[model samples]
Target: MNALSDPEPQRSIDVAAVSALDEPNRRRLYDYVSGRGGPATRDEASDALQIPRQTAAFHLDKLADVGLLDVEFERRTGRSGPGAGRPAKLYRRAERDIRVNLPERSYELAGQLLAQAVDEAESSGESPRTVLARLASQLGHDIGHQTGGSDRQLLETLERCGYEPRVEADDIALVNCPFHKLARTHRQLVCGMNLHLVDGLVTAAECPQRHARLDPRDGYCCVRIGTTTD
Candidate 1:
């Protein structure tokens, strides 16, 4: 699935998973397991790291519990059935990409959107900017649809997209821009895309009275959601 359509649980970083690495032993064990090309048993990790088997097992299990590691069971002796000995528990790095950012950023999502826009523009002989606006709008529409397409849920949907919406009188101002860094360097392109994105969201949510426009205020998103009168 596209990054935008990924299940919320998969796209978001697990705070507990990041916290598990704060422990020195657990961090070291995680690094060792991640560096290994294949799964490592507790005994192998303890021997390589010069730690007690029990300690290694505890750290490894903690990592697995937090979804930082994937666990499996197998017989190392290349045998199965009775008398072949019990299966050894093994640990390997989880395939999920875990990222933690203060205030939460969606640079990866922005990258994917820009890349797709470029590809589509090249194939269809359309301006990259034009294609980008369309893509962003469509994505916003999908998001609004997913949130039940109601005016009341607009703030919730925007928050989930990292917009950090704030209500001021009749207008809703976005306090955080998910593509803040990108917008600084490519203000026109990023802000235009942001405007179309919110436009699509407002349209799909059936909030016809609300309009998204480029207000470009300091310390806020370039696009502001205001009523038709504004």
Candidate 2:
């Protein structure tokens, strides 16, 4: 088995950062700063965009406050000590990536797991599918362990992972597949991985009464967590 680090926590779109760009002046300033290839000063932005310096400053500060732009202070004149004037505040594109999706999807997470499986298989001379199942299982185990080993935790974990789990009596049915598109195109591969992942989750969570199995149905995830009978 190959060692893998836990996936980075998912980040939802920052509404405030996005809303700040709704203003025309602020949006223009953001575009200018992002395209400038370097930090921009208020004077530079005002002159380039033909906006008033005060207007540019207000919008720039707004952008920075909302995290749409990063702020830095530097003496552009290359001077030192008290003899030099106060460092000018400059604006640049923020390093954070922002994305908005309706209903929320985690294609990136699926992609990362697939890529890791391929890399590990190539290096270890193992079957790609085999490696993928192992990787997915390990990820599920990690998620279960982190969320605490309980039935409630398992459901919460699935929900957080975009599974949209629905409870029916003692069984849980998933209404959404985070890797929907991928699963549609590569049903067997993706579904197999999904089963192993969910199975691992159930095992790690110590859900003795739950059993994960392939119960493919229309408009539902391929894997279903059903109640186990003694």
Candidate 3:
């Protein structure tokens, strides 16, 4: 479709957030603080982990910086007199979720689109599959039109969607399935939807020479782009 938007932002941010756990002390501090229902003070975390107070503070701050932890300021002691010191810094698990899967899966996106399609179909008295296929195809068509309908452009769009396309002589094989886990149990449903989605992409990209075909393999995705016969 139109020039594909880069997927680098979310992928990079997720990787960074996940990598924060690689630090032993930071991971420990995160676990200790998050395991509790209430936010943890630096002193509580340091005491629990046997790490120095300063070290715990540093790691907790780092975790907060990366969005893996939320920071708040509160007085641990009930006393609120003038003699009371500044509010103690507290740490808790951030509400944000961070997933860093290699090869990147986006089953959630597919599920949302499918659910929306079903709802629309039900309300409009249209076939659910037909509505879904039309929506998926229109997405591809719009992108193709935006990207100038080039093979390279189409592949770029697929790559951004995490298809991991591998170009062969006259075909393209997807090395990664964005709906891998979902496809395991819902194989027929997901694969059929994927096939139609890709076909829509190809058709809209104006690549009449090639079409998406279901060629399920042991380790690869269920869809492949093959040269059209006649």
Off by over 4 Å in 3: 1-98
TM-score of 2: 0.55
What is model 1's C-alpha RMSD? Answer: 17.5
Q: Is candidate 1 or candidate 2 better by TM-score?
A: 1
| Clashing residue pairs, backbone N/CA/C < 3 A, model 2 | none
Model 3 quality (TM-score): 0.55
Q: Give a tens-digit lDDT track for model 1, residues 48-151.
A: 99999999999999999888889999999999889999999999877544666423468888899999999999999999999999999998898767665455
Per-model lDDT: 0.83, 0.81, 0.78
- lDDT of model 2, residue 59: 96
Maximum-lDDT candidate: 1
Greater lDDT among 1 and 3 belongs to: 1
lDDT of 2: 0.81
For every candidate, C-alpha RMSD to the true structure in Å: 17.5, 18.2, 16.6
Q: Could you estimate the TM-score for every candidate?
A: 0.56, 0.55, 0.55
Q: Judged by TM-score relative to the true structure, which candidate is superior, 1 or 3?
A: 1
